[model samples]
Target: MTQGGEAAQHARDEGDDGDDAPATLPELYAAHRLGLVRLALLLVDDLETAQDVVQDAFAGLHARSRRLLPDPDRALAYLRVSVVNASRSALRRRRTARGYVPPHEPPGDSPEARAVLAEEHREVLDAVRALAPRQREVLVLRYWSGLDEAGIAETLGISRGAVKSTASRALDAVEKALEAKR
Candidate 1:
């Protein structure tokens, strides 16, 4: 067997064989790693940090598999929550560190530079970044991650009503920010 297959078998061996138990971490990682990383990127903005956040999420899931593995859906939910929380923690640490550090200059591009995103896409991303953290999370989870209000509420540990209101307010804020930039 391949290394990943061996790891999956080991993970399965360590966990209970209950009917509700979710797929092994290696299986989930193989299937959803890219999507989880993309989710982290939307939350954290930096590719490296996003990858770390997804890795941390899977590590957290593996650590808690005894409890979380009971229900596959719940395990997936736990992973999503873990990723969001890890991303938040990373962002918080970054903000704290940035306070003590001086800003650096951007890297100079060479002649082989690729094309930048369209202005509209840049504006949308900028507006998303400008939102408050909770508002941003609501928007990204709802729109980008394609979670419904209840799913977002569960992921965010907020009420469904709060998810709706936050999403509404976030959309308004994004629209206003984009308009101001025009």
Candidate 2:
């Protein structure tokens, strides 16, 4: 162990490094998780990515700590740094993976992208994701895939009339969802 590590070990062995600090992993996680996630969210701009960054930060600390952090408060500082670095890495990965589109996302072809950039497409994307699975499947197949009702029915294993109804209903639901958001 390094000199700092030896000192931290000695502090832990002596117990009570003062101020009623958390000495265990669970306690540390409980104390700092919310703040860490918020920090990550500010950097990453998405709750899921922020949560992932925090989790990864904790996991990295765990990997090195050998099941017990020698100094939990110092470990929290380490975790804050790790979360920041991990969020940067996440943004870089997202930038490099520009081709990846999540399911149910309407394609952002240049013209449509420009059109919706004026109107906030997040509402539409959220509406699509909120759709029922069958409805979503029908809508994507019919519109994005440029399939006819019969083709969508064939693909989704439903009757043509069912496909027509599902698509109509899905479109109505998406409209309602967007309207509600507005």
Candidate 3:
């Protein structure tokens, strides 16, 4: 069979890769986009920055889709790693920007929905910002990005035991901070 014929037969035999049916890059993006965005938001503590981070991740994923994973499950894993890296990059950039004039706050008194979202957004952002950098990164990768300890460790370049301990410590710290804030 020609290459095209083989690809067609494989596609048919695979039945769209079964439950893993993210047949195209766009399909993969659609399935995981919102969750990835939210994970990035929690990691970076800024929604606009989160969107940018997710965007960069998607771009990277698109470029490497063919070589990164033959199966959708693994592609999702690749996307998760991309998001984590992009979010960390955004955090570094924000650190550099901190030396400039104080960051501007969004104006208050918009529609009711906007007002409510703004309040909740600030609360979550504050809670995340209270975490130590390593703790925050571990927590976001494990819980927010839905990565297992091994995956988190691999992504963060730490050991699995370290990921577990740091995640436990991070959760304790976050709870304490929230409790104290009350």
RMSD of each: 26.3, 17.7, 26.3
Give candidate 3's root-mean-square deviation (CA, Å).
Answer: 26.3
How close is every model to the real structure, measured as TM-score? 0.43, 0.45, 0.45
Task: Encode model 2's per-residue lDDT on 1-182: one tens digit a residue.
Answer: 99988888887788857567777788888989999999999999999999999999989888878544876767988899999999999999999899777689766579877777756677777898899999999988977899998899889889999998888999999999888877
Rank order (by lDDT, best first): 2, 1, 3
Candidate 1: segments with Cα more than 4 A from true spot? 1-22, 101-182
Better of 2 and 3 by lDDT: 2
* 13: Cα error in model 1, Å: 18
lDDT of 3 by residue, 14-117 (tens): 76643556768888788889999999989999899888888888888778878764677777888789889988888888788886787688776669978878
Clashes of each: 1, 0, 0
Reference-based lDDT, each prediction: 0.86, 0.87, 0.83
Q: What ranges in model 2 sit over 4 Å off?
A: 1-15, 99-182
After TM-score superposition, the amount by which residue 146's alpha carbon in candidate 3 deviates from its true location, in angstroms, is 64
Q: Which candidate is the best by TM-score?
A: 3
Candidate 1 vs 3: which has more lDDT: 1
Runs off by more than 4 Å, candidate 3: 1-14, 100-182
Q: Pairing residues by index, what is the TM-score of model 2? A: 0.45
List the lowest-lDDT window of 10 residues for candidate 2: 64-73
